[model samples]
Target: MTRKASGAPGQDGHDDLQRNLTNRHIQLIAIGGAIGTGLFMGSGKTISLAGPSIVFVYMAIGIMLFFVMRAMGELLLSNLQYRSFIDFSADLLGPWAGFFTGWTYWFCWIVTGIADVIAITGYAQFWFPDIPQWLPAIACVLVLLGLNLLTVKLFGETEFWFAMIKIVAIVTLIGVGLCMVFSGFVSPAGRQASLANLWNDGGMFPNGLMGFFAGFQIAVFAFVGIELVGTTAAEAKDPERTLPRAINSIPVRIIVFYVLALVAIMAVTPWRDVVPGKSPFVELFVLAGLPAAAGVINFVVLTSAASSANSGVFSTSRMLYGLSLKGDAPKSFGTLSSRSVPSRGLMFSCICLLAGAFLMWMIPDLMEAFTLVTTVSAILFMFVWSLILLSYIAYRRQRAALHQASRFKMPGGVPMCVACLAFFAGILVLLTLKDDTRQALIVTPLWFVLLGVAYQFVRRRAVAGVVAIQ
Candidate 1:
């Protein structure tokens, strides 16, 4: 997919999107984006699947994804005119690459948004048990849509606070867990609090090869939004400075948020006892003789889900807007509101998201449907990520001078891209081992098939128009 060195279309380093995102906003957005509901809620399921080895799962995924982020950061900073990887894909790979990458990324977020809305409804049930689940789901979507429609800065501020709550909660949890470990606190189950809990029961890989492999299925979903910072390049006031700083801190964030937080939870309560569906964080707090903290943790998890959903709306609309600018989607989507927001695209995505939420409501088997939706989302996200890596490969091969000129060049370069791609492939293979994910893996191809068909029609129409003009 490499191309000759050529300037990208609309390569002026300016756009309709307002560059109001300062370094602080970008930094927090990166942090907020990386920390998702998956950590707060989904980790319970992952812990159950992989036992104590879930720590390794988070670390491995973080390392591989950090490389992916490095590749993305290099590509984005290579040319300031490139809004995101989607733009670079178009320029470096081809229009079809851009179309597929943009739309697949959009679809990924929409599916994720559906999951978040459902999670939000479940969380709302804690306070209002009598209320229908659908009510909170609808209210959440509507409210987030309204807020996002106002301004991009508002989205940043919202995520900033949402991420702060999560950070505070984790810090508190870690502090409490440390105290318990040092003071020799014991859980009600008589499980002594100790760091050895990570491997004492049956070693780190207690679940053996199969269980560790199975953990990847759920753990990969936890990292869906890790690349979200790249999307903000267009709106970032100083992408070169802000994007690098945000990306460079990924290892540290992963250590604190994912690794340390999970370690704390498992140490306080044995991984074998961690409920699959229930939140471990909430349980740990309750075990520590602070039942009220369960509600507070619930609120944090609720906000975390909302933040991810809010991000879904923001990212999906922007992706659609970028696609439209490339003549890959309806022109209406490219139109920006007076506030420079992609209102039309945002509304369209919200409508589709509402439809998804409605379908989830109508379905009798919620868990079954959710499993399929999430698996599909994860697969599509992998495709989008692969495209970014592929685009980076093309950028490096075709634009040699550009690579040499880059200050934030990807560390491992092509070998790292190949490794990440291999890792993603390994995840797909692991998906085939489970019945739940296997079904989604089987059905996931239909999406790419549809995209291929759409591309052919788009290409035919494009050729016909070009001939008609001639």
Candidate 2:
């Protein structure tokens, strides 16, 4: 199939972003986004906090985000010229919506990148206990930066393999875990593996309602990048075909990768026995008397962290590229390199990622640092998702013809959009119930305040430029 250029020509006569990502790239990118570093590293903490009820936490978030992706898919397909949700948001809502959504989305990934960096450092400690945590963190940032600087297609290929690793590890975990349950495998801790382990200890809601609420604090982080395919609309080959295929598979991915994997881990290890600081995936393999397999699981999870960071780097640069085109960001960000990648934005994001190493240096406790950053990332992501829903609502109102015409119309339309918004608000209220999350929540508004100020300045400068030109 012949592909058309998705971006306009720049001063140097190079296309903005090439349509080099095929259906396979989009499919794997969706999978990579569905399974995140939080699932591999933070799920242990979630299980420890919410016990078996953490399953429900993940299911609820996944279902809501599936709807968000549906809304995004429909909007992106409504107009092929729309580079991403940011473009539609600007058109359907206003310029401010685009500016806020664009920059906020960029910040979301930067913060998420930091969390992934911290996760990579923690996962590295699992293999090399004596190594400095900051070393691995900085090394990962540099490696991903180089790969991303080469080409957008290379970024897609890199994510394809990274995501494949996560898929194999999760499938292996679920399969091995089920075998142990069926064979009545006994662990070194004298616990027999069984499906009943889910509730046999203290029932599914072992820690009660508050425990269930606490689960959202980190479980939301696991779904941070679920809407990432929305960001690839500009570069995805035959987006109308690939985007829907990718979005439609989300439910299955969540059921298998998240719900089933967690079920398997809990069945083997039991909720109470799972260590909050260590990955339950590695722990499950160790309990199965395969220390070698446990080491392999550790490596898989380290790669998972790298995958999430890689997505963060890719999306943030693209978002900056979008923002700069609209004059919401500096013009330098809008320029593409000779390779057709956003090298300037890539470098900026990588420098921000190095702060992860600095964070590790400042906060010696890995989990503590991870929780704080992931919480902040989650909150900012919620804002971006909310804007997507809001844009959908506006689209439905103003462009009813577009809605009726869309082959990929959002299921349930505006009602579902409002419901999802309510669900997000509930999660925010839940965030206030804990000290760690509440601390992050309290500081989140400061981001919006800063954005408000910056928007005014940008608007004035844009008006002045037009006046000067006239």
Candidate 3:
């Protein structure tokens, strides 16, 4: 089950700094990455905007993404040679593929980090209505820095607890929602609500084909950090066993947390009553006669936001570390500290996060900044997912003879990967509508332009260094 490392770790002056992240930490961190605070808060808007059709949107995207993960899983399980998806891209495509994959991924995490910080301020406003939003945002940034700076296991354990809060909250919600659906819980309106509400409003596809498609556009955002589980492969205790087990559960988790949860919600409350500005989750427990529901949800959601931002830091830092090792990033970032953590890379990302927070704070128009940041992140994540699939296709093409001899193989093979790309391209086209999602479309391309510029700089340095040596 032990596969060899693809390349020896680059001597970053602190080889001992690598952390021993335990299985528990990785498990919870994977779960934490999957649970976005946006789902807790933003789902109401999606429901309101798309109605019952949102359920289908979640399911469709889930199926497509599950295939994407399966491809990654089979590839990673096949050989321990690849570190991150970037390494796989390099091995499958070329060294330049690694450069683009690594940087795009780094940007993906950075943008996600910005969004998480925005979500923190937005979530904080629920409790501290009077406090200037930036204060809590600043404090949370500092808190994230201090927490991550200690050690990887601590970060993992910390994310484990954060993810747990969100997980428990979600399970409780699904349970309560089911009770209301079957047992007839009396709502705030003094009337009984039940399963009939789901279809009675207009059936599951009330939004029509377009509505269903629109739902996918918004729903895809909930699945943004899902790739984080694969990124942890390099640090896994026994990746061959743990990676497959962890990944195999994604479809179930996605269905339970997203699809079923959405079904239960619209079933109880109807799609129209769901609002975009507030959480239907909080409203649900309140409707179910729990006065302290707001308090309980607040605590859960606070952790959800923190968990996302925390994972953002972890993922981005690790990506940079991986990039540094591949000769794509500044050598300083490759330095792992004494705690076995990538101290320099970790600090670099945290500093960038704080800078991101300041930009949003200074803007004053929080909504615009939040939208631009998140949409860009979603687009970048899609790019990364696309690359992973492309890498798989390349892996199969190059290693056909070898793979034929291996046991772990990607199901549906080339066709599945091609379909995933088509699905992503459709999402890209959907991004052009100048409403809630248009900013993402605009900014996402700009990000690539920036990456292209940086790619040139790195390529030149790499060429010059080789020439001088010769």
Q: In order, what is each prediction's RMSD in angstroms?
A: 3.9, 3.2, 3.6
lDDT of 3: 0.78
TM-score, each model? 0.96, 0.95, 0.93
Q: lDDT at 333 for candidate 1?
A: 84
lDDT of 1 by residue, 285-356 (tens): 888899597789889999989989988999999999898877788878888888878898999999888899
Q: lDDT for model 1, please.
A: 0.88
Residue-level lDDT tens digits of model 2 in 1-470: 12222357545433368788999999999999999888988899999999999999999999999999999999999888788889999999999999999989999998888877877887788889999877898899999999999988999999999999999999999999999999999987799999999988889999999999899888998888988999888888688899999999999999999999999999999899998978898888877778597679878988988998899999999998888888889888877777878888899989988975585668767667667778999999999999999999999999999889999989998999999999999999999988889999998999999999999999999999999999
User: What CA RMSD would candidate 1 show?
Assistant: 3.9
Colliding residue pairs in candidate 3:
17-340, 17-341, 18-340, 19-340, 45-276
User: Model 2 Cα displacement at 31 (Å)?
Assistant: 0.6
lDDT of 3 by residue, 101-219 (tens): 88898888887888788777777888888998678877887888788777777887888899888888888888988888788776666556777777777777677777666665666
* Overall lDDT per candidate, in order of appearance: 0.88, 0.89, 0.78
Top-TM-score structure, candidate number? 1
Candidate 2: which pairs clash? none
**Runs in model 2 lying further than 4 Å from the true structure:** 1-15, 129-134, 364-366
- Ranking of all predicted structures according to TM-score, beginning with the best and ending with the worst: 1, 2, 3
Q: Model 1, stretches more than 4 Å misplaced?
A: 1-12
